[model samples]
Target: MMPLRNPKHAPAAAAHLSRSAGVRHQGTKRSLSAQRSPAAQRAAPLNLEIEQLREKGNAAFKAGSYSIALQHYQEAQGKALTCRPVDDDLQARILSNCAAAQLHLGQPQAALQSCKRALQAVPNHTRALGRAVTCHLRMGGFSAAQGFIDALRAQPLTQAEANTCQQSKDALQALVQQALARAAKAATAEEGVQALAALEACLEDSHAPCMPSLLLTKADLLLLLDRHQDATRMVLAASEAAGWPQERLERYSKWVHAHMLYSQGQLDKAATAVSEMAEAAADDECRPAPALLPSRSAFAMLQQAEPQAFRDLAQSLTMLHQAKEEGNNAWRRQDKAAALNFYTHALEGITAPPPVFAAVVFASRAAVHRADGRLLDALADSLRSLALCPLYMRGVLRLGQLLTDMGRHELAAQELGALQKEQAAAARAHAVNATCIDLWRDVDAALKKAKEGQRQRRAIDHFEVLGVPRTLCTDDEVKKAYRQLVLKFHPDKALGRCRFSSAIHTTCRPSLAQSQLEERVRAQAHRVFSMISDASTALATRSSRITLEAQLNVAQYRTASQQQPYSPGRYSGAYQPRSSTARASRQNAYSKTYSNDYYDSDYYAYERFWAS
Candidate 1:
């Protein structure tokens, strides 16, 4: 009964149920539409932000602030990623910006990675494709860049982007043509340098175009220009870029390297370089040995001669300088004994044969004599020193002073006068001189002293100076005397080298004592030493001894012609009268004057004794 009653209302109930279902469906639809509205609103703001970021990046790029542009683009990229899904085109743009910045910054590897990522995001993206092409080219990936360029051309791109790709290819072609044309011109005209420059120049979007042939050519050109290291670098770089075996490439580069080393006059080093390359090559290499170093029997003569011809004199100088330096260092330390000792030893070791340096040391020793009141010794040293180097300014000045001190004032005046003339000539030539006035004063003072002095000191004859028999001494006897003197006074032995006796050591320590004698005695001893040196020099040579004996005989004569000017040796001057009349009238007075000089009179007596 209940079921029958519900049947009548079934239609209405079914209609009510259908209406309820429709209401629920409409609510669901409204809820879904509400969710969509918020997302759309969020999308607008996010897209605005992305656009703003992109615009900022573009502005920075336009301002030449590529690094700033890269930062902005990166921020945009990050933000895009923060969204539900990233925009491929936007990511691509960001990546392109990043690559462009990195490329300009000379970070080709970083730029290449960025471009790769960009191309991955939007394979057909025109700007991304162009950046990848440029990056690949920069990193020297010629084939890969060409592939990318082909892909980019195949893609649908804007007119401006298409123009960029087309221009890059066209410019690359132009660069190659230009380089090749320049190379041809250089080769034909022997302009190797220009050809090298052309070959080395890179196109804006092209890999290094220096092939093996070009590198070899440039290396030859560099060798011609005397750029050995540069040529080596070029050759090595070519070998590496070619990805060829070292042995295969070493032949050309090695020869070039060896030639360059040889051309630079490094023959031994060139040989060493060849030997090294040859050793590295071993049995695996077949290249002929480098034509640089020759170690043959014939070249051995050159090696042998090199020391005698080139380095012998230099080596001798080195030794001489080293010895002199050692002596000077000791002298500066106030070790007078050690200094003099070293100076004398240094003189003995000199191999250059001339006593030029001996003169200087003698002059130095003369200072010690003056300081010790050994005036005669100082005078003697002065004369020898002057004889050795007349032009030595210190020696000249000092000798003049000594001559004045020793009562040889006229001779001092004459010596100083010659120096004055030279100094005047130098001044006339506009040479600067701080010592001019002082020198003039010195000369005037000496001249005044000479004018005041009554008589000059006596000069020594050679035989008494040598302590040998005057008229006839065999060479052996002379040698024996010389050996004895050298043994006693060799500078290396401090005791023997001192000019004065041990009695001076009692007055002052030997290290500080040059002499204990009075000024007159010291001056006499100094003259004796000079005469001894002259005797030794004369006796050392048979021919020189003959010449000396002749001079000595001529000196003994008192003829009027003997009044004529007598030239002294290199380092000393002779005592001369002040005027012509004085010189002529001195004939009778010569023997008397030189009797006091101690040599001529002693020699005259000795000559008579020997004649008997």
Candidate 2:
């Protein structure tokens, strides 16, 4: 006889049926031996063999050796069948176990066949019904799975089995929808192909959201047909909708925006974007579409048009601004050399700066010059700043202050007075708010000081102050004159005199007012001492003397038109000039000698030559 297959639970149930059959045979063989049927007698030994086989199968199944377990269960089922009468319930369970083992072995077809037999043996078998539902769902039999589900739900079930049945039903419905969606997608693809074919047949115009492949193919077809312009347009549109073309569009928009910012003079923002774009270009993304490339577009017209070059410019500008900031901080700390170095670096870094930024830097550098008493250089820078940006208030104020310090007080007064009037008029006409109120106050004070200085002006030539002629004085003569004067007006001599006066007045305990008056006198002495010191320093060198002589002549000419007369001071009486004929000859020779070769410290190597 052919062996019957078993599945899960078959081994345990068969083992139990064999034990009960053994008990009945034991009672019959002992108490009713003569009356016992031959078949019953034969079934007793078969029952014992079935029990042993069932135990081994159960162990194999528990150990996860499903093939071995299935074999043992099959043998047990065969032995059970050879008994006098078969247990229908036991037969159903063993067949269900066989289906389970087949399911685990990935033979759903065979498992389903075993399940049908199990259901036939006991029509209301729950395990067989559940297993059959799973097999149909796995095979994509939605309708068949639904039939099994309905049958599963009708049977009496535990909570877990009922939940599993509901899950299977849900899965079946979802699979049906998925199949339908896949079919519709396939149809759509076919329709797209047909539409392209029809367009090719018509040889006419068309226009998605369509796949890039289809669009590219259409573009090629148009090209082959010699519709060059249409082909180009189609290619552009397709690129705009897909691939690297979309990325190019975004990049192009950013470039345009940055260009606009640059045009509006928003340098920092535009440069920052250029730097970020350059960094992003290092990625492995495709090159921009040829038509959208900057070199092929209007963006190429911008300054520093290449992406890498623009990024370099941005970095350069950032460093320049940082230097400018450092210069400003150094100036605030009163570090003149450090401030000048940083400002010079900032200026040298940019070959062409925006006029507004250049104007501001120039004015700041002029402030450094004015503080160092290089009035000619200060004047030049301040004027250049104003030339670059005529409305720069700080530059205007610096120019006024520089002129006053240079003793062109009348001119300083005139320029500042004009600026004050112009600003007031502008404020009235344009309703322009005064943003530089403090600056205006400073300008007002400078104008007042210039007017006062103009009234009491003394034409004290630096050369004359050192008891030397304007021209033809040798460095030795200049040095000799400076030493002779230093003995009288040196800071050390002035301090000693101040101490002597204070000691003399100490016996009389001077009041606060008297102390303040003494302090003012000392301050006035130091001021004169500094002026004498600067005069000596300027006249000590031939180059500086030449430069200063040129500056003085310019100042004299400026004052000559005003007809300002020179007033004799205490030092003026100490100086005597050479004969007029000799002086005149030397002056003429000096003018001709250094006129073209003179260098301005503001632009040339003033510090290097000065140090030497």
lDDT of each: 0.51, 0.55
TM-score of 1: 0.29
Off by over 4 Å in 2: 1-267, 279-298, 301-307, 350-352, 429-435, 453-612
Residues 31-73, model 2: lDDT tens digits:
4334334544444343677778878877887788889878887
Clashes of each: 15, 5
Worst lDDT run of 10 residues, candidate 2, spans: 500-509
RMSD of each: 27.2, 31.6
Model 1 alpha-carbon drift over 4 Å, by segment: 1-47, 153-196, 203-612
